[model samples]
Target: MNSHEGRPAGLRERTRRAVQAEIVATAMRLFLEHGFEATTMEQIANDVGISRRSLFRYFGTKEDIVLGDHAEHGLALRAALEARPADESPWEALRAALKSLFESLPYAPEEFIKITTMLHASPSLRARQLEKRQQWAELLMPDIAARLGEATDPMTRLRAHALVACALACSEAATDAWVHSNGTIDMERAYDEAVAAVRG
Candidate 1:
Protein backbone atom coordinates (compact mmCIF):
# COMPACT_ATOMS: atom_id res chain seq x y z
CA MET A 1 0.00 0.00 0.00
CA ASN A 2 1.03 3.60 -0.50
CA SER A 3 2.53 5.41 2.47
CA HIS A 4 -0.56 7.63 2.62
CA GLU A 5 -3.04 4.76 2.28
CA GLY A 6 -3.42 4.10 5.99
CA ARG A 7 -3.42 7.76 6.94
CA PRO A 8 -6.68 9.65 7.49
CA ALA A 9 -7.70 11.51 4.34
CA GLY A 10 -7.89 14.78 6.29
CA LEU A 11 -4.28 14.38 7.36
CA ARG A 12 -3.04 14.10 3.79
CA GLU A 13 -5.14 17.05 2.67
CA ARG A 14 -3.97 19.19 5.61
CA THR A 15 -0.35 18.39 4.81
CA ARG A 16 -0.85 19.40 1.20
CA ARG A 17 -2.47 22.66 2.29
CA ALA A 18 0.37 23.46 4.71
CA VAL A 19 2.98 22.93 1.99
CA GLN A 20 1.11 25.10 -0.45
CA ALA A 21 0.73 27.87 2.14
CA GLU A 22 4.47 27.80 2.80
CA ILE A 23 5.25 28.10 -0.90
CA VAL A 24 2.92 31.07 -1.30
CA ALA A 25 4.23 32.80 1.83
CA THR A 26 7.82 32.36 0.69
CA ALA A 27 7.01 33.67 -2.79
CA MET A 28 5.19 36.71 -1.34
CA ARG A 29 8.17 37.59 0.85
CA LEU A 30 10.61 37.34 -2.07
CA PHE A 31 8.35 39.35 -4.35
CA LEU A 32 7.92 42.10 -1.76
CA GLU A 33 11.66 42.28 -1.14
CA HIS A 34 13.02 42.03 -4.69
CA GLY A 35 10.05 43.11 -6.79
CA PHE A 36 7.84 40.75 -8.74
CA GLU A 37 9.90 40.81 -11.92
CA ALA A 38 13.09 40.08 -10.06
CA THR A 39 11.80 37.04 -8.17
CA THR A 40 12.13 33.79 -10.11
CA MET A 41 10.61 30.37 -9.43
CA GLU A 42 14.08 28.97 -8.78
CA GLN A 43 14.73 31.57 -6.08
CA ILE A 44 11.39 30.82 -4.41
CA ALA A 45 12.07 27.09 -4.44
CA ASN A 46 15.50 27.67 -2.98
CA ASP A 47 14.10 29.78 -0.16
CA VAL A 48 11.34 27.27 0.56
CA GLY A 49 13.87 24.39 0.45
CA ILE A 50 11.85 22.59 -2.19
CA SER A 51 12.77 21.43 -5.66
CA ARG A 52 11.89 23.77 -8.53
CA ARG A 53 9.80 20.97 -9.97
CA SER A 54 7.77 20.79 -6.80
CA LEU A 55 7.12 24.51 -6.93
CA PHE A 56 5.88 24.16 -10.48
CA ARG A 57 3.57 21.35 -9.37
CA TYR A 58 1.95 23.68 -6.83
CA PHE A 59 1.79 26.79 -9.01
CA GLY A 60 2.06 26.91 -12.76
CA THR A 61 3.43 30.47 -12.83
CA LYS A 62 4.86 33.12 -10.55
CA GLU A 63 1.54 34.98 -10.65
CA ASP A 64 -0.23 31.88 -9.47
CA ILE A 65 2.02 31.76 -6.43
CA VAL A 66 1.16 35.36 -5.61
CA LEU A 67 -2.60 35.03 -6.02
CA GLY A 68 -3.30 31.41 -5.08
CA ASP A 69 -4.76 32.37 -1.72
CA HIS A 70 -7.40 34.51 -3.38
CA ALA A 71 -8.82 31.35 -4.95
CA GLU A 72 -9.31 29.86 -1.50
CA HIS A 73 -10.84 33.09 -0.26
CA GLY A 74 -13.29 33.02 -3.13
CA LEU A 75 -14.45 29.57 -2.11
CA ALA A 76 -14.85 30.75 1.46
CA LEU A 77 -16.96 33.68 0.33
CA ARG A 78 -19.24 31.32 -1.61
CA ALA A 79 -19.62 29.06 1.37
CA ALA A 80 -20.41 31.96 3.65
CA LEU A 81 -23.10 33.24 1.34
CA GLU A 82 -24.58 29.78 0.99
CA ALA A 83 -24.75 29.36 4.74
CA ARG A 84 -26.61 32.61 5.32
CA PRO A 85 -30.24 32.31 6.47
CA ALA A 86 -32.59 31.75 3.52
CA ASP A 87 -34.69 34.77 4.51
CA GLU A 88 -31.85 37.24 4.12
CA SER A 89 -31.85 39.49 1.08
CA PRO A 90 -29.21 38.90 -1.56
CA TRP A 91 -27.39 42.14 -0.79
CA GLU A 92 -27.42 41.50 2.95
CA ALA A 93 -26.08 38.01 2.43
CA LEU A 94 -23.34 39.25 0.09
CA ARG A 95 -22.27 42.00 2.49
CA ALA A 96 -22.01 39.65 5.44
CA ALA A 97 -20.18 37.07 3.35
CA LEU A 98 -17.63 39.59 2.09
CA LYS A 99 -17.00 40.89 5.61
CA SER A 100 -16.40 37.37 6.84
CA LEU A 101 -14.14 36.63 3.90
CA PHE A 102 -11.93 39.69 4.38
CA GLU A 103 -11.72 39.07 8.11
CA SER A 104 -10.39 35.57 7.44
CA LEU A 105 -7.40 36.72 5.37
CA PRO A 106 -3.87 36.30 6.77
CA TYR A 107 -2.89 39.91 6.06
CA ALA A 108 -3.26 42.88 8.34
CA PRO A 109 -3.87 46.37 6.98
CA GLU A 110 -0.10 47.06 6.79
CA GLU A 111 0.60 43.83 4.95
CA PHE A 112 -2.33 44.46 2.63
CA ILE A 113 -0.84 47.86 1.81
CA LYS A 114 2.43 46.21 0.86
CA ILE A 115 0.62 43.71 -1.33
CA THR A 116 -1.38 46.46 -3.01
CA THR A 117 1.80 48.41 -3.63
CA MET A 118 3.49 45.40 -5.19
CA LEU A 119 0.51 44.71 -7.40
CA HIS A 120 0.35 48.36 -8.57
CA ALA A 121 4.08 48.42 -9.34
CA SER A 122 3.94 45.38 -11.60
CA PRO A 123 1.99 45.51 -14.86
CA SER A 124 1.75 41.74 -15.20
CA LEU A 125 0.65 41.31 -11.61
CA ARG A 126 -2.04 43.95 -11.96
CA ALA A 127 -3.36 42.18 -15.05
CA ARG A 128 -3.34 38.87 -13.25
CA GLN A 129 -5.27 40.43 -10.36
CA LEU A 130 -8.02 41.55 -12.70
CA GLU A 131 -8.16 38.10 -14.27
CA LYS A 132 -8.50 36.50 -10.87
CA ARG A 133 -11.30 38.90 -9.89
CA GLN A 134 -13.15 37.91 -13.01
CA GLN A 135 -12.75 34.28 -12.09
CA TRP A 136 -14.14 35.04 -8.64
CA ALA A 137 -17.19 36.64 -10.22
CA GLU A 138 -17.79 33.63 -12.42
CA LEU A 139 -17.48 31.33 -9.43
CA LEU A 140 -20.05 33.29 -7.45
CA MET A 141 -22.52 33.98 -10.26
CA PRO A 142 -24.28 30.63 -10.27
CA ASP A 143 -24.94 30.75 -6.56
CA ILE A 144 -26.14 34.32 -6.72
CA ALA A 145 -28.58 33.41 -9.45
CA ALA A 146 -29.93 30.47 -7.49
CA ARG A 147 -30.41 32.57 -4.39
CA LEU A 148 -32.38 35.09 -6.41
CA GLY A 149 -34.63 32.25 -7.59
CA GLU A 150 -33.80 33.08 -11.14
CA ALA A 151 -33.54 30.60 -13.97
CA THR A 152 -30.41 30.33 -16.05
CA ASP A 153 -31.47 32.85 -18.65
CA PRO A 154 -29.73 35.79 -20.25
CA MET A 155 -31.45 38.25 -17.97
CA THR A 156 -30.47 36.30 -14.88
CA ARG A 157 -26.85 36.19 -16.01
CA LEU A 158 -26.88 39.92 -16.66
CA ARG A 159 -28.26 40.59 -13.19
CA ALA A 160 -25.56 38.42 -11.63
CA HIS A 161 -22.91 40.24 -13.62
CA ALA A 162 -24.19 43.60 -12.47
CA LEU A 163 -24.25 42.57 -8.80
CA VAL A 164 -20.70 41.23 -8.92
CA ALA A 165 -19.48 44.34 -10.71
CA CYS A 166 -20.98 46.69 -8.16
CA ALA A 167 -19.74 44.65 -5.21
CA LEU A 168 -16.18 44.51 -6.55
CA ALA A 169 -16.17 48.21 -7.37
CA CYS A 170 -17.20 49.01 -3.83
CA SER A 171 -14.49 46.77 -2.40
CA GLU A 172 -11.83 48.28 -4.64
CA ALA A 173 -12.88 51.77 -3.68
CA ALA A 174 -12.71 50.92 0.03
CA THR A 175 -9.24 49.37 -0.24
CA ASP A 176 -7.93 52.25 -2.33
CA ALA A 177 -9.12 54.80 0.20
CA TRP A 178 -7.62 52.82 3.07
CA VAL A 179 -4.25 52.49 1.34
CA HIS A 180 -4.18 56.14 0.29
CA SER A 181 -4.89 57.22 3.85
CA ASN A 182 -1.94 55.20 5.15
CA GLY A 183 -4.27 52.71 6.88
CA THR A 184 -5.33 55.31 9.40
CA ILE A 185 -8.90 54.81 8.29
CA ASP A 186 -10.74 51.68 9.41
CA MET A 187 -10.99 49.35 6.40
CA GLU A 188 -14.17 47.67 7.56
CA ARG A 189 -15.89 51.01 8.05
CA ALA A 190 -14.68 52.20 4.67
CA TYR A 191 -16.00 49.05 3.07
CA ASP A 192 -19.36 49.46 4.75
CA GLU A 193 -19.56 53.09 3.62
CA ALA A 194 -18.80 52.09 0.06
CA VAL A 195 -21.52 49.46 0.12
CA ALA A 196 -23.96 51.96 1.58
CA ALA A 197 -23.05 54.49 -1.12
CA VAL A 198 -23.83 51.98 -3.83
CA ARG A 199 -27.02 50.96 -2.11
CA GLY A 200 -28.33 54.55 -2.12
Candidate 2:
Protein backbone atom coordinates (compact mmCIF):
# COMPACT_ATOMS: atom_id res chain seq x y z
CA MET A 1 0.00 0.00 0.00
CA ASN A 2 1.15 3.56 -0.66
CA SER A 3 2.40 5.18 2.52
CA HIS A 4 0.34 8.30 1.84
CA GLU A 5 -2.84 6.53 0.89
CA GLY A 6 -4.73 7.17 4.13
CA ARG A 7 -2.67 9.94 5.66
CA PRO A 8 -4.44 12.83 7.36
CA ALA A 9 -3.73 16.41 6.38
CA GLY A 10 -0.47 17.72 7.80
CA LEU A 11 -0.55 20.34 10.51
CA ARG A 12 0.28 23.27 8.25
CA GLU A 13 -2.29 22.19 5.70
CA ARG A 14 -4.89 21.64 8.42
CA THR A 15 -4.18 25.06 9.85
CA ARG A 16 -4.45 26.63 6.43
CA ARG A 17 -7.80 24.99 5.78
CA ALA A 18 -9.07 25.97 9.22
CA VAL A 19 -8.22 29.57 8.54
CA GLN A 20 -9.73 29.36 5.10
CA ALA A 21 -12.96 27.98 6.51
CA GLU A 22 -12.97 30.63 9.19
CA ILE A 23 -12.54 33.30 6.56
CA VAL A 24 -15.46 31.97 4.52
CA ALA A 25 -17.67 31.64 7.61
CA THR A 26 -16.79 35.10 8.81
CA ALA A 27 -17.10 36.63 5.38
CA MET A 28 -20.45 34.99 4.80
CA ARG A 29 -21.86 36.24 8.11
CA LEU A 30 -20.65 39.72 7.30
CA PHE A 31 -22.06 39.54 3.78
CA LEU A 32 -25.41 38.29 4.98
CA GLU A 33 -25.55 40.87 7.72
CA HIS A 34 -24.30 43.84 5.72
CA GLY A 35 -25.14 42.89 2.13
CA PHE A 36 -22.52 41.75 -0.37
CA GLU A 37 -21.85 45.11 -2.03
CA ALA A 38 -21.73 46.91 1.29
CA THR A 39 -19.08 44.63 2.76
CA THR A 40 -15.39 45.40 2.31
CA MET A 41 -12.28 43.25 2.25
CA GLU A 42 -10.87 45.08 5.22
CA GLN A 43 -14.02 44.40 7.20
CA ILE A 44 -13.81 40.70 6.41
CA ALA A 45 -10.12 40.59 7.26
CA ASN A 46 -10.61 42.37 10.53
CA ASP A 47 -13.47 40.09 11.47
CA VAL A 48 -11.45 37.01 10.55
CA GLY A 49 -8.51 38.34 12.56
CA ILE A 50 -6.26 38.45 9.54
CA SER A 51 -4.57 41.31 7.78
CA ARG A 52 -6.06 42.45 4.46
CA ARG A 53 -3.00 41.10 2.64
CA SER A 54 -3.39 37.77 4.39
CA LEU A 55 -7.01 37.70 3.34
CA PHE A 56 -5.89 38.22 -0.25
CA ARG A 57 -3.46 35.37 0.20
CA TYR A 58 -6.45 33.21 1.08
CA PHE A 59 -8.88 34.57 -1.55
CA GLY A 60 -8.37 36.77 -4.59
CA THR A 61 -11.68 38.62 -4.34
CA LYS A 62 -15.03 38.93 -2.58
CA GLU A 63 -16.54 36.81 -5.32
CA ASP A 64 -14.03 34.09 -4.57
CA ILE A 65 -14.88 34.40 -0.89
CA VAL A 66 -18.58 34.05 -1.64
CA LEU A 67 -18.06 31.10 -3.97
CA GLY A 68 -15.37 29.66 -1.68
CA ASP A 69 -13.10 27.06 -3.30
CA HIS A 70 -15.22 25.71 -6.11
CA ALA A 71 -13.94 22.32 -4.93
CA GLU A 72 -12.74 19.47 -7.16
CA HIS A 73 -15.06 20.34 -10.00
CA GLY A 74 -17.51 17.56 -10.82
CA LEU A 75 -15.55 14.88 -9.02
CA ALA A 76 -18.61 13.78 -7.10
CA LEU A 77 -20.68 13.92 -10.27
CA ARG A 78 -18.07 11.98 -12.21
CA ALA A 79 -17.80 9.31 -9.54
CA ALA A 80 -21.56 9.12 -9.14
CA LEU A 81 -22.02 8.91 -12.89
CA GLU A 82 -19.34 6.26 -13.18
CA ALA A 83 -20.99 4.21 -10.45
CA ARG A 84 -24.39 4.32 -12.11
CA PRO A 85 -25.74 1.12 -13.71
CA ALA A 86 -24.35 0.93 -17.23
CA ASP A 87 -27.64 -0.22 -18.75
CA GLU A 88 -29.56 2.86 -17.61
CA SER A 89 -30.66 5.25 -20.33
CA PRO A 90 -28.82 8.57 -20.75
CA TRP A 91 -31.51 10.65 -19.13
CA GLU A 92 -32.01 8.27 -16.25
CA ALA A 93 -28.29 7.90 -15.67
CA LEU A 94 -27.87 11.67 -15.75
CA ARG A 95 -30.83 12.14 -13.48
CA ALA A 96 -29.42 9.67 -11.01
CA ALA A 97 -26.00 11.23 -11.28
CA LEU A 98 -27.38 14.69 -10.65
CA LYS A 99 -29.34 13.52 -7.65
CA SER A 100 -26.42 11.60 -6.22
CA LEU A 101 -24.03 14.49 -6.68
CA PHE A 102 -26.48 16.89 -5.10
CA GLU A 103 -26.93 14.63 -2.12
CA SER A 104 -23.21 14.11 -1.63
CA LEU A 105 -22.24 17.73 -1.20
CA PRO A 106 -20.83 18.61 2.25
CA TYR A 107 -22.58 21.89 2.87
CA ALA A 108 -26.08 22.27 4.29
CA PRO A 109 -28.98 23.76 2.33
CA GLU A 110 -29.07 26.85 4.57
CA GLU A 111 -25.45 27.63 3.79
CA PHE A 112 -26.09 26.92 0.13
CA ILE A 113 -29.09 29.23 0.17
CA LYS A 114 -27.11 32.07 1.71
CA ILE A 115 -24.26 31.65 -0.74
CA THR A 116 -26.50 31.02 -3.73
CA THR A 117 -28.85 33.86 -2.81
CA MET A 118 -25.87 36.13 -2.56
CA LEU A 119 -24.56 34.84 -5.88
CA HIS A 120 -27.91 35.45 -7.61
CA ALA A 121 -28.09 38.97 -6.21
CA SER A 122 -24.70 39.99 -7.57
CA PRO A 123 -24.31 40.09 -11.35
CA SER A 124 -20.55 39.79 -11.11
CA LEU A 125 -20.88 36.84 -8.72
CA ARG A 126 -23.47 35.24 -10.96
CA ALA A 127 -21.14 35.66 -13.93
CA ARG A 128 -18.28 34.15 -11.96
CA GLN A 129 -20.45 31.22 -10.88
CA LEU A 130 -21.39 30.65 -14.53
CA GLU A 131 -17.72 30.61 -15.44
CA LYS A 132 -17.19 28.01 -12.72
CA ARG A 133 -20.10 25.98 -14.05
CA GLN A 134 -18.68 26.15 -17.56
CA GLN A 135 -15.41 24.84 -16.19
CA TRP A 136 -17.36 22.07 -14.45
CA ALA A 137 -19.19 21.26 -17.69
CA GLU A 138 -15.92 21.01 -19.59
CA LEU A 139 -14.37 18.82 -16.92
CA LEU A 140 -17.45 16.63 -16.64
CA MET A 141 -17.91 16.14 -20.42
CA PRO A 142 -15.55 13.20 -20.91
CA ASP A 143 -17.09 11.16 -18.11
CA ILE A 144 -20.61 11.98 -19.28
CA ALA A 145 -19.57 11.22 -22.86
CA ALA A 146 -18.10 7.90 -21.87
CA ARG A 147 -21.36 6.96 -20.20
CA LEU A 148 -23.44 8.10 -23.17
CA GLY A 149 -21.00 6.35 -25.58
CA GLU A 150 -19.93 7.23 -29.17
CA ALA A 151 -17.01 9.25 -27.84
CA THR A 152 -15.36 9.45 -31.28
CA ASP A 153 -18.33 11.11 -32.97
CA PRO A 154 -18.93 14.86 -33.05
CA MET A 155 -22.66 14.40 -32.55
CA THR A 156 -22.05 12.30 -29.47
CA ARG A 157 -19.82 15.09 -28.17
CA LEU A 158 -22.64 17.51 -28.75
CA ARG A 159 -25.04 15.20 -26.97
CA ALA A 160 -22.70 15.00 -23.99
CA HIS A 161 -22.53 18.79 -23.95
CA ALA A 162 -26.30 19.01 -24.00
CA LEU A 163 -26.65 16.51 -21.20
CA VAL A 164 -24.18 18.33 -19.01
CA ALA A 165 -25.80 21.66 -19.75
CA CYS A 166 -29.27 20.36 -19.03
CA ALA A 167 -28.17 18.67 -15.83
CA LEU A 168 -26.47 21.85 -14.64
CA ALA A 169 -29.45 23.90 -15.65
CA CYS A 170 -31.64 21.61 -13.62
CA SER A 171 -29.32 22.10 -10.68
CA GLU A 172 -29.45 25.87 -11.08
CA ALA A 173 -33.21 25.88 -11.37
CA ALA A 174 -33.69 23.68 -8.32
CA THR A 175 -31.34 25.80 -6.22
CA ASP A 176 -32.91 29.00 -7.49
CA ALA A 177 -36.30 27.73 -6.45
CA TRP A 178 -34.99 26.53 -3.11
CA VAL A 179 -33.38 29.89 -2.41
CA HIS A 180 -36.49 31.66 -3.57
CA SER A 181 -38.51 29.65 -1.10
CA ASN A 182 -35.97 30.36 1.61
CA GLY A 183 -35.39 26.61 1.95
CA THR A 184 -39.04 25.82 2.62
CA ILE A 185 -39.39 23.76 -0.59
CA ASP A 186 -37.68 20.44 -1.03
CA MET A 187 -34.75 21.14 -3.35
CA GLU A 188 -34.24 17.51 -4.29
CA ARG A 189 -37.90 17.09 -5.13
CA ALA A 190 -37.69 20.23 -7.21
CA TYR A 191 -34.65 18.77 -8.95
CA ASP A 192 -36.48 15.51 -9.69
CA GLU A 193 -39.37 17.48 -11.12
CA ALA A 194 -37.08 19.56 -13.33
CA VAL A 195 -35.42 16.44 -14.70
CA ALA A 196 -38.78 14.79 -15.25
CA ALA A 197 -40.03 17.80 -17.12
CA VAL A 198 -36.97 17.85 -19.37
CA ARG A 199 -36.96 14.08 -19.83
CA GLY A 200 -40.64 13.98 -20.77
- Say which candidate scores most in lDDT: 1
- Provide the clashing-pair count of each candidate structure: 0, 0
Q: In candidate 1, which residue pairs clash?
A: none
* lDDT at residue 140 of model 1 (Cα atoms): 74
TM-score of 1: 0.85
User: How do the residues 22-91 of candidate 1 rate in per-residue lDDT, one tens digit apiece?
Assistant: 9988999999899999999999999999999988888999988887777878788889888888777777
TM-scores of the candidates in the order shown:
0.85, 0.86
Every model: Cα RMSD to truth: 2.7, 3.5
Clashing pairs in 2: none
lDDT of 2 at 39: 98
Steric clash count of candidate 1? 0
